[model samples]
Target: MVLVPLLRGCVQLLTLPIHVLAFLGVWDPLCKTTFPYFMSRFARLYNQKLHKEKQQLFSNLADFAGASEPLSLLEIGAGSGANFQFYPPGCRITCTDPNPNFEQYLLKSEAESKHLHFEDFLVASGENLHQVADSSVDVVVATLVLCSVSNVQAVLKEVLRVLRPGGAFYFLEHVAGDRSSWIYFWQQIYDPTWKYIGDGCSLVKETWKDLEHAKFSKLNLQHINAPFNWTPTRPHIIGYAVK
Candidate 1:
């Protein structure tokens, strides 16, 4: 019953080159090519649940907005287009990320979808999504995004602003652990170092509190503790919220 260490998880270590390059401030070109390529493989591997949880999430998303004439989705951190398969037919995707290096991989994923086409790829960060027009998109997605942003509140505000009325915000993210546990102490010690090499991922982000404070009228959120048993900072929240 031994779970793999967090450092060995597909996401925790992204790509060794990307981290070392990030540390050196000289790996952008290499990261754009190598990191995205490697990320896609690891992401899918890490996401293998005992049941089809993600499929259900995407199914619900389709039911909510898929019937419209032209449904659109703005994903906060569309890393290598990992969610492309889950998208229902005819959903136009607009992906945003601070690293413009992922453009090639995103396009590659778009082509692979053959169902969800690309709208645009914005070279922007989650906290500042000014590139997207307010109240324009039908759905906003942020899987594994809130954990890294410097200001989660600002990101929530932008997500709300960009979403059309009745539009839904879908997310799946990990967060801070219990205060009394040794895991919390480990997280405190490792967070800064982890954030540096793990692409700004904060091991102890209290993102559930931010989601609670958001102006969403309806939220069907649930906790995910079983699948992420591999790490102490592995408490995850996943579901949809309607604006």
Candidate 2:
């Protein structure tokens, strides 16, 4: 008797398993390739308006010592240089990122925000930025960085140390959800797994509390809930503080 052969197949569970796979570096290539493309697209859409609203903050990022010198700005975790477009014209920038995967993206964004001048790109982490001198920069920007860092206090102190007496530290971050809400509980529960998969982002960080204690000369902060962003990380803060 002859037997017929049957086709074989297995079902793949896409959602739940991706978390573990991403934890294993399986998603590194996709993250590196896709991040810049999405960042550029989003920057172009919101940068102009964001700059317009935050123009005063950007304008304050200047030195009057001599008109010949452009304002110097240092950004920690400058992923893809996405915030460059929001800076004032001719402001000189030095970008640093822990992930060198974004080197090419930074170069691309360097051209898009042509008004600002890029001085260099350093491979560095936010927790330690010793290469930048104390009170040396007119401004320091950190967007969407603190939650993933090893030490938020250390990073904030570094920002304060690098900024000139009157210089400003501008930041935009998605902090933890309200403590009273169930979202906060979920955030806490998912933190370990999320951090492992989402590049060390602590979705439950009460980052504003830290900023308040950081002792900025003057801090002006506002909390916002951004629509369409992931719920656990939707509690946002955008502000500037003088060092």
Candidate 3:
């Protein structure tokens, strides 16, 4: 018992430097730099697995824009521009992300997506999109973003503010499972560590509740298990809400 306590103390002492660096914000930039690389690989696998669902979800976007007119799309948390391929043709996309490191990846993805036009890349967070104008975008998109936002309600409000009168907001997010399910229990257990490792992503956010209360003029949302190996992210909600 004494040996175990001594080893625990020694481990804490060994990790003191790392804690100090984290406190001084040295680790943040490093994490930001490395995260995009891993995320890009994961995005490829995730897109492949959820191709059908994404196709169905994105098919509805054609209704928002005419054949001749290009749609003005604002994507919040547009990491690596992973959804660019699914967007309607001739879309003018404005990408915003909290991580500036993703800009390079976004540019690469934009080059590969010939059907879409890249407008601007803003370094911003979903909770506060001060750079974007009010009612300026025809569509606002958020995928796998609400889980990491500090305030989901604030992000939703920002999404609504940027969208035009008859605009739409599309979201695909992993949410907490039912209260009585084992998945929910695992989510609760993994949430604390997941936040740090997953870069502030919460494993247990009931994002559907926030969307329902967001006051969208017409809300159409549904839940399904995403075709991914990660159990925490399996319980997903995907759909669009009209403003």
Most lDDT-accurate candidate: 3
lDDT of 2 by residue, 97-136 (tens): 8888778878888988879888888888988898898888
Q: After superposition, how far is residue 87 of candidate 1 from its true place, in Å?
A: 0.7
After superposition, the stretches of candidate 1 with alpha carbons farther than 4 Å from their true spots are 1-37, 66-68, 226-228
Tens-place lDDT per residue, model 1, 107-221, is 8888889887788889999889998999888899888778888899999999999998889999888777777766666676667557754567898887888989989999888
Error of 2 at 137 (Å): 0.3
RMSD of 1: 5.5
| Per-prediction TM-score | 0.83, 0.79, 0.89
Candidate 3 lDDT, tens digit per residue, 88-182?
Answer: 88899999999999999999999899998888999999999999999888889888899999999999999999888888999999999998887
Lowest-sum lDDT 10-residue window in model 3: 3-12
Note the Cα lDDT for every prediction shown: 0.78, 0.74, 0.86
Alpha carbon lDDT of residue 36, candidate 1?
A: 63
Model 1 clashing residue pairs (backbone) = none
**What CA RMSD would you report for each candidate?**
5.5, 8.9, 4.5
